[model samples]
Target chain A: MHRIGDAPKVRRALVSAAVILSALFLLLPLVAIFAQAFSAGADVFWRNITQPDTLSAIGLTLFITVLTIPVNLVFGVALAWLVTRFRFPGRRLLQTLIDIPFAVSPVVAGLVYLLLYGRNGWIGGWLDTHDIQLMFAWPGILMVTIFVTCPFVARELIPLMQAQGSRDEEAAVTLGASGWTLFRRVTLPNIRWALLYGVILTNARAVGEFGAVSVVSGAIRGQTNTLPLHVELLYQDYNTVGAFASASLLALIALLTLATKAGLEWRAARREA
Target chain B: MSIRLKNIAKTYGKAGRGVSRALEPLDLDIHEGELIGLLGPSGSGKTTLLRIIAGLEAADTMSDRPSSIHFGDRDVTHLHVRDRRIGFVFQHYALFMHMSVFDNVAFGLTALPRKQRPSSGEIRARVQRLLEMVQLESLANRYPAQLSGGQQQRVSLARALALRPDVLLLDEPFGALDAKVRQELRRWLRHLHDELNFTSVFVTHDQEEALELSDRVVVMSNGRIEQIDSPEVLYRSPANRFVFEFLGDVNRLEGHVHDGTLTCGDARLDVDLDEGSHELLLRPHEIKLDEHPTELAHLPVTITAIAPVGAEVRVELEADWLAEPWLATIRHADFERLRIKRGQRLYAIPRQWHQFPAANQRSIASETMS
Candidate 1:
């Protein structure tokens, strides 16, 4: 009567292996971050967090994330709606293109933006004459962060929206609901959970993004340095506790995002059941 | 509303690379308050035609004669689905999952423009009335997920009727329900259609549903309408072979006809057919079985299977002449009198049969027992 992989010995072994691996690769690092951050006592950790440069980096990171979330939210919903609801030429191509951010290395995307909008680059030369500084500035940091985080919301929504289909929206329209009314009442409610999950993911990626931001931001302290980039700067300056302090902040955000995602998934499953 | 569709057609792909036609340019006139069933198998353009009538899809315009649709006196070919003032019930119900049954029913009323919208009190009363009509007032507070499939379907019906549309279109409305639930829903929908007096069109592949529910059934196949008639007329006289085959179970009698007789293997039947290969069709009910062979038909068959269900007993017959098994339906009394059983040998007599010749297949020649 035993099913495949259902032996007590085998099941126990698999469960224990999974738990050990998770503890080593995931839980241990999270614990180590807070441990190192407070190794020099709470005062040093507090000092590192309250430093003017760290404060500025935190503010800049929050600003970029706040802007990036709404932009990607709108883009993701619109893209998911367009590709799922309508049939047209190049729809498959557009769907594939949305995953470009996920496929291309973040640093390569940053370089591409730099080459296109940097001072010596194509669009940058014209902008430079107008004194528009995109690269090596807060705008450059924002741009690369947006590039890395753009796909999260859309990626989360596409499969879900596709599975749900457009029948509800079509029903609304046939019942005298206008475009905006249908979207607001039917489509929005249907996709709200996935949309929120996407935004949380986008926020997490935007806050933690370093590779692309470093390529474009030039890591100017208190000016264009994001939180992740500032952590690297502190680490390179031989400040381990300071580095871990910033990393702990990121770890908290990641934890919060994971919690929110799990909560949303649990609610969604209950609603479906 | 009376619906008139003129030269409506649909093509799926672009013109150059293997464009497939979903529907041909054809015209149809549906009378006001008529409950028409677009009966067809899958990919038969019944749904396409319904969507075109609902303005959910645009019919292709021909170069010579442009396609157009009309609702009563209003020309609605160019109207959006929202502006067309039609109600559509999707196959899967498509009730708003987050909304309660009451809220789902009230959606169309609340979605109206501010100037045209009814008061919240009026909307609530209307929704309540709709829920009552569907016998779902008790479940009005429940979300769609909390309801059974039948309850969800009723909620969708209430939602569609909330707008008080002149025309209601349903795509495979009861296709998802169990047999008993589907039957109940079909009767309920028919009652609602009669009471509301709306021009209703529903698509279904089930012949029994179409025949029982529709005032007129439009039998379609291969993107073409084979026949449009009342259930009685459709059952009694189908337009062609496709219509006959699609309507109900048809047993084929294929053999060479010569000198007023058709012969296949050792079995022979008296047939007044031309001297050539011919095929005859008979309904299960049109077949009769006896212990001894009759002079008119010496068709000997072995009783392979017996299903004594419902009001009749269905007997499956097999013979050397039959390329496939033949089914005969007899009354329970007859089944008992004959005491038929599996593996028993019997004689089959065609009480009535129909023939649709290969050439000029539209004409039907039917013969009944003298």
Candidate 2:
């Protein structure tokens, strides 16, 4: 009953079907974005970038991304080390809480932050007296980006840290290394590549955040709007050239991220070598 | 070197927990400049004992030694594992995957304090010398993953000895290598011991390895020290049943003693003393397998199985003597001289009266049932 068909041919057919489906799912949106970007000429792209509103929006988005990425990178790795390496009470609960942004919709994460930092909300009255604004401000936009991308670094680093055998540290300590030295000399070198890989991934996610930043940003045209929101605003104002141009800029970041991922693979191969 | 443990017990968890005991109380004295083999099956507390001796673990109590280990009077039990100055080679070698073999061997020197530590040149010289000792100087620049299993083990050994530790603890050092590699390393380890003469304690279940390598073998079973004797002393005269069975193969014959000689239905055996409700233990090769019998424990037997293992051949014998089954071993030359056959009847005789304190008496009856 099992010998009716050739096994290798069936396996190839199934594998190719999976490969094609995966390619269509991941590459379709990039194809559409590229198609839209090149639909207009470089002259139209330059015209959009020169517009005052488009320029401010681009500056604002890059500013928020530059602010948010390092914070998320440091914050994510610290949390990853804490949750994975230490024995602490409420560790399981904290692990689940750290992953809440991944489980919740980005819109909901933005709303939760907005409610906490709004004019009449908790911690908002004190800030109001100090003339500090978060909701509808660049602070709120950056905060929303942080919330959405919080788990990326930890999700990458924790398993790598855990998988590194504890014997090296034990051996170090037995060899007269102090606890700090053990962590520095043995633990750090072992996980440095993986930790750097995680930082790269988290920074990419923080810079590319869209839905959460848009909800908290209040869609301020030139001040608080990020790149994704800028693209949408340009589209609604019957500015197809500006919208596609900004979209192409975000796609460039994506391409850089893909290149970084490829570089990371090469580094990994060299490490194994 | 020169260690002592008093009433050392290690119980893992609560009584109602899955395993009640990891190790029971034990007392041991390890001499300086002598290699001791801790022999046991798996889960037999050999590793736990080695860890305790290295001060990597705290015994539940050590009143005699103040819960401490003293390498020439430096109390190290309460000190953290780093300050103990004991070298350890784990079963997996545990070499740093990222570091070169030179750096791995230099790790301990790099880990030492400023005033107490050796200089960079001194560390390099020491690593080179240790690498030469392990015969791994050619592979010093390579990482651990690039080396063979034996080479990795040698690097681990080099790293451990780099510290010039007072004592070395090896937890099944050759257990990870292949059988042929294990045999070669076993000889290399013995040669290295003669060259350096460091106080070493190794744990292994391979009796042949224990006998061939160490000056003394400490046979452990059920978390306690069953017997500690020299390799020759242990094989020629085992202390108990577990030691006898664990060390090598044995054949048993049941008999009762009238006066000072053991008597069965068709056989009478000479013994050092009277034996009642006792079983006789004998080694197979020591027995004489000849058809023209003598007056003794002789039985008309047939060969059931013939297994030729290198120089020795284990000839399983089934006899119409009285009660149960028996096995006998003969050298290749002896089996050839006797012309033993599978179905032909032959006289199975005792080589000598090999007796010891009997354990597993109930299990002997149960063995027949099986």
Model 2 chain B lDDT-worst window of ten: B361-370
- Over A1-273, each residue of candidate 1 has an lDDT whose tens digit, in order, gives 869889899999999999999999989999999999999999999999999999999999999999988988898899998999899999999999988988999889999999999999999999999999899998888888888888888898899999998889889998898889999999999889989988998989999998898899988899989999999999999999999999999999999989999998998898776
Off by over 4 Å in 2: A1-28, A50-98, A117-144, A161-163, A270-273, B14-16, B58-66, B114-117, B254-276, B320-327, B353-370
* Model 1 Cα shift for residue B311 (angstroms): 2.0
* Candidate with best DockQ: 1
TM-score of each: 0.96, 0.85
Q: In model 1 chain A, where is the ten-residue run with the lowest total lDDT?
A: A141-150
- Report lDDT (Cα) of residue B353, candidate 2: 44
Candidate 1, DockQ to 2 decimals?
0.84
DockQ (C-alpha based) per candidate is 0.84, 0.69
Model 1 stretches astray by more than 4 angstroms: A1-20, B359-370
Candidate that would win on TM-score: 1
- Give per-candidate clash totals: 0, 0
Worst 10 residues of 1 chain B by lDDT: B359-368
Q: State residue B298's C-alpha deviation in candidate 2, in Å.
A: 2.9
